[model samples]
Target: MQYLVLASRCLIGVVFLASVSTKVAGPAAFAAFVRSVRRMLLVPSGLVKPVAGVVVAAEAAIVVLLAVPTRATAVAGFAVATGLLLAFAGAITVTVRRGTRTTCRCFGASTVPLGPAHVLRNLLLVAVAVAGGVAAPTGGSLRLGESLVAAVAGLVLGGLVTVMDDIRALFHPTPASRRH
Candidate 1:
């Protein structure tokens, strides 16, 4: 149980860290993310920057909350993470349904348009949040060996999740005929 909770916490924290890093990497990155959000949500231009700011702040909060080694804080972090993931999934669903080809500025300068794959990825993250929340312990400490193992597992899983788009592209490269 401790392993599960720790792994979950690390995984969620790493994923959010990656996300927040990309969006705030520079002024241009953030502006691109805001544009993508506006197109994805069909929000008024005026609200786009504020909405993007809130999203980035929320992601940062999750990372901070999960970093705390307390049960309550960790659970709160998981809840926040779940809420954000669900919101993202819902927005992505709407965008895909509307056939909007908005570029996904998620995790840096992704040129890939909004699609079902994005929705699926968000849903998967939500599952991780729920599992972490459910298994979270009130108070516990992992041994050195256990800590190292759990941390490594979580980091690897988080890294893989963050780069899933790239992984998919590798498997489904554009056909040679289309390159002409």
Candidate 2:
């Protein structure tokens, strides 16, 4: 159980880090993607850039906050994950309503379309965060090796998933064909 909790924390931390890094690495592209999604929902165009900045900052903060050795880490992770899930859900709804099948852009330049799979991924992360919050662990002792290993594994997992999106896009091409 303790191992599971630790693994969950690592996974959540890695996921947040990867997600934020992608956005930070390509602010213009992320902003453009945000604008595309916003336009689909008929949101005021003026708010797009600001909203994109806020989202990127929030995600980065969540990753940093979760890495801290404090009780607040779990809470912050939970809040971040919940907020992310809600945001993605809203985006999915808007995209579906507008009938605009654009790439999700969740992982930088990935061609994975915004769909139920994306929503489910966010929801699963939310669940992991919530579980971590409920089982918040003390960070008194320094298990540097173990912790480092977990963090690295988490990051690798995130990278693999992001790459998988690209691989699927390459082989499958269109979103509709990939879906079936």
Candidate 3:
């Protein structure tokens, strides 16, 4: 049970950290991704940049809050995850209604488009966050060994996901026929 809870927490922490790192590392790319979604949604052009900034900042804060060792951190993480999922659901609904094909800006500059997959992903994250919040860990202080291992695992997972695009491209080189 302890290991299960620890695993869940680590997964959520990794996900949140990855999501934010993408935006923080490439603000301009993230901003462009957001702008594309806004255009697809027909959002007012003036509001695009501000909205992107707010989203990026919120994601970063959520990652930091979730990574820290505190009881309240789980609650805070759940709230943020829930809010993001709801917002994503709304956006996906609108995109479907408007017959717009737009990429989900959730992961910053990924080429993956906004679709049912994105909605499902958020829903899954929401579930994980809720579970972690409810089962907030309580124990004697973490030994330095445990803390170090958890932190390293979280960072490695986050870093891998953050560079998923590059990683994929490296393994699956484009065919010459498709490269024009």
Best-fitting candidate, scored by lDDT: 1
Q: Model 3 misses residue 37 by how many Å?
A: 3.5
Write model 2 residue lDDT over 50-129, tens digit each, in one string: 77777778878777777775667766766776787677667776676677777666666665566766666677767777
* Per-residue lDDT of candidate 1, residues 71-123 (tens digit): 98889999999999999999889889988878777777666676888898899
Clashing pairs in 2: none
TM-score of 2: 0.76
Comparing 1 with 2 on TM-score, the higher-scoring candidate is: 1
lDDT of 3: 0.63
Q: lDDT of each model, Cα atoms only?
A: 0.86, 0.67, 0.63
Measured by TM-score, the strongest candidate is 1
Model 1, poorest ten-residue lDDT window? 171-180
Candidate 3 wrongly placed segments (more than 4 Å)? 1-5, 137-180
- TM-scores of the models, in the given order? 0.92, 0.76, 0.71
If ranked by TM-score, best first, what sequence of candidates would result? 1, 2, 3
Give the per-residue lDDT digits (tens) of candidate 3, residues 1-180. 233335456766677666766666765767666677576655677887777677767777777777676767756866786687567677787786777866555555555445665566667766766776666655445566776676566456545644554565576655321211
Residue runs of model 2 more than 4 Å from their true location after superposition:
137-153, 170-180
Order of quality (lDDT): 1, 2, 3
Of the pair 2 and 3, which is ahead by TM-score? 2
